[model samples]
Target: MKKVIKIAGILFVLLLCAAYFLPAVQSYSHIPGEIYILKGSSKTIDLGLPVKADVDSSGVVNISGETLEKGALMQSPLVIKPLNYGKATIELSIFGIPVKTVRVNVTESLTVIPGGQSIGVALDTRGALVVGITGVQVSDGKVENPAREAGMLPGDVIIRANGIEIQNAKQLMKIINETQGTLALKLDRNGRTIDIFVNPVHDPSDGKMRLGVWVRDNTAGVGTLTFIIPDTRQYGGLGHAITDLDTGSVLSVREGEIYFSEVIQINKGESGIPGEIKGFFSNSSGHMGNIEKNTEFGIYGKVFDDVDLSAFGEPIQVASRDEIKTGPAQILSTVDNEGVKAFSCQILRLNDQREPEQKGIVLQITDKELLEKTGGIIQGMSGSPIIQNGKLVGAVTHVFVNDPSKGYGLYADFMLGMLD
Candidate 1:
């Protein structure tokens, strides 16, 4: 009987060891967002927006900002957009593996105002919304016009003409105060370049000149790098469409342009706080690659300069969608000290088609270096190549909002197929 008891004790000890060291109990899941994958395959991804909702019974997963339920799922479709010329994470995912973000360009009409009651639109400083303005500024007052008698300044930029662009100061001042429902002129005075906006302000006496707010022409910051496809000498970036960030509208172009940027600055990030990459947008005409487009996948353009960008010997092959094993990997981006540095990462959680967001691939970081600067993957690193098993799997797409070290990537096959 004592011998039997000893054997039972030994068995218990072995079981304990197995429980302690073996891989985790394939638990609920990884990360913060709700999960929802394509009903069939993980290859099909969704890039749409999500709204708050109560958990439903079938095909539903609930996710919060910090905590997560392992092995559980909640949502569907992934939507991405870029902000500040792509410098900030308007929407990005970078925690573990490759990163991802989408760039949407908005084109707005220019509002010109001469003077008096205004007409036209003005773009919010962020470039998101363009609304009708009623005022603007008066420059180089005409001699015979009431503007001369009204004494409008030369450097004064307009905020609203009672608001819009006009032919000359004559059309202006002559129409002041006559405005009932309309007012114009919003402007700025920068050195010699005087700018005028058409927004309205209230004026009681003879109402000579009035402006509503301040405006600027310069746009700065970083953004994602979509793709660099080649047709002999040229390469294109952004596999999909370019839309306006503020309005969430796509841009139609005669011909798109590419620029070579040197990374002079970086902003390291943390949970709930994302970092950034800074570079100069140049018009120096990079090597002329090619430009092509597809409604489903978006656009494909080429880069000109053949320098180091094209020199990488072997390209990573796109593994079968079924072959993307969730594990170790790395990405090639322009974050290194020398530029376009390669960083380490881990495959934290993956989306199976049966799960929620079947939007290609998602990963988490295990690299300390990348975690130190720019969190995992910040803005301007999108489209960086994800190399695994000596194959080029996809490009970075989004960064996890709450976690800087983790993000998302898209299958290169999907993006490349669109180009062909």
Candidate 2:
């Protein structure tokens, strides 16, 4: 009888051990590695586990309710109060065992007017982008691919040739046509610099020297505007980077512009077929802003003084990732001749992202009007502002090709960080 009691005690201790460690393992995915809080403001976060938090720098931030009772299965709230504009680290532990460390940044609160108007983006790449490699016919009736022979790929950006910086496809062509022998070329391949020597072949058809490579220097498209900062007049749109359709490489911005556009047509989306919004904007007038940077997050620039701000309404508060929850939301977008309108949607999933990511929110369109108009989220709807609980939470990023009603969104906090 004593042996049986001893064995039962051992089993109970093992069960308690599993309960303690199970939440510790799950905390890694629920808590972010870094978080930003507004200065002088307090934020309460629930990690779904009872844990203790310790701050490394007391001057920057302070933690309230630092300890939670052990053996409690319910989620515990940790209140973070930012004291100043600086940085600090918070270490989370369970029963004196450290589980995760989160970097906390105290920054000034920012508010911006959410934009849903359709805008035209005209971006000129920093250098000519090679889109394709083909064979060049020589005078001897033989074909040679000089670009491939020189180890050049389709996605390579020819930045310099023969010690001259190349700005456009026409300029690169001029340099190749004038070159006599093997030309030294500098290329930007996936952010890495490489130098190669390529022998230009004289094409019998055009009677001009050719590298047997197709290059493009500019790209243009229509997209919804995300937000506009009132203080700096800076604007962010697209919610994601613009890539070349042929090479699938992110376009490096040299100079670009955004213009006011009007939605002329909308092709309804269908299963396996992504629709698009067609709009027209004049290059001479309707200028809204200048594109300064094209990053993985989106395109950012300063807006012109003449930009119409009355259409976007008043500026709204921006919500951090932790502040966002899965529930009903609304997205501001322009689909037809009418101006921006709010459409109902639902936040299906929210990802706890430690690093910057584009697809952090999975959402589904639920508005019967929107579902009937565009057949759900379509192309050119990217960067549509998502409003939840009266706060700007995120923007539309991408659509699930298989399901037109479902799409991905990016956190507004990540987009705002790019402004800094």
Candidate 3:
């Protein structure tokens, strides 16, 4: 019995050791397929083993050692620094065994003037978005849902009405009100364009023609400006896409505008209840820019001459994900009418994202003023520029509902890639 017990204890110890070391080696084996490195920047990667850095293009990259050096440290991280602007491949090997191949893209030193001023985003959808369909009361007191009868469903985009292109909800309403009989609607249902016929009902309550469908053509909200490219006079904001309030679908933007805004109130955040920063758009000739694209990485467009970028100070070079570390950082956000202020934050987590994702970095608000006022990140704080080590690393995105102090951020590399 003593022998058996001793053997069991030995086996348990071996299993525990394997459990700790196996996953670490497995995770280390899984390096990013592609890594973006800015010119003259360095990235450190720990693979849990000695690695020989072999750069295909010597002109673009500089390895730590010679071609026949043993490797990076057995347990230490490998430091790969970019020397010039070009593409190269860094082959990492352990004792001549190729373990991983990283496509190193040494890009130009891209810089942007960080923006924190709150800008009112007024987006006009390409077509009216159908949110819901309900029964409409006619003159005879009969309730009818014409849109539903025509197979029209929520999430459908109405593009045309009575052979005319419908740009907004008001235009669709006007045609319906003036139509003598049945109306033809060209709709885009999940990208399948089709036409549907529905007869409008004259409501007794207001004597207006009704389709019994709730549709919206425009949306407006406030968000912090992320950056403005000096050479292009273009800017981007709201690291994540602008989703509809009802259906939660990404809105397809036709055209939009940015206006100057000021925060009026702040709803303190708590666990499970997200907070918001309410602001009013200024109609005082503060037209700042025009939005042209609405992508998963936010909105991008041209800026007007009236927009004052002097408040942003100087342009900062962007940082790739390879350069982001889990440590101290700061975010530029406008929580009030006082303009942009830098708030300290800590990067708690960094995700391995080969593709574009909004939650590339997780950060916690550590600024006393921001915490005291908003209780962490709030709505309208999206697009706040995240700076780390004097580089623009990302932009603030969604706040965690269970922890308002923590929120997601999009890597600046992803946002800058969308400019073209």
Which scores greater on TM-score, model 1 or model 3?
A: 3
RMSD of each: 17.5, 4.1, 5.6
| Candidate 2 local lDDT, 210-269, one digit each (tens) | 999999999999999999988889889999999999989999999999998989999999
Model 1 alpha-carbon drift over 4 Å, by segment: 1-241, 284-299, 305-313, 352-358
Model 1 TM-score? Answer: 0.46
In candidate 3, which residue pairs get closer than 3 Å at backbone N, Cα or C atoms, i.e. clash?
A: none
Clashing pairs in 2: none
Span of 10 residues, lowest total lDDT, candidate 1: 112-121
Q: What digit string (tens of lDDT, one per residue) describes model 1 on residues 1-420?
A: 999999999999999965853332212122223221222222223422232222222122122321122222324443221111211111223222222322222111111110000001111121111212223334434222232233334334333354454333344444543665444344333323333323334444444544322222212233334444332432223323444454333332333334455567787767787677766545462323334441334345444455455443333334544446678877767764365556677665556432223146787767787777677877666666666665555666678889877788766556655544
Off by over 4 Å in 3: 1-33, 39-98
- Once fitted onto the true fold, the runs of candidate 2 whose alpha carbons sit more than 4 angstroms away are 1-36, 44-53, 65-79, 92-95, 98-105
For every model shown, what is its TM-score relative to the native structure? 0.46, 0.88, 0.81
User: How would the candidate models be sorted by TM-score, starting from the highest?
Assistant: 2, 3, 1
TM-score winner among the candidates? 2
Residue-level lDDT of model 3, residues 261-330, one tens digit each, is 8788889998899888898885683889999988899899988876667755899888866678999999
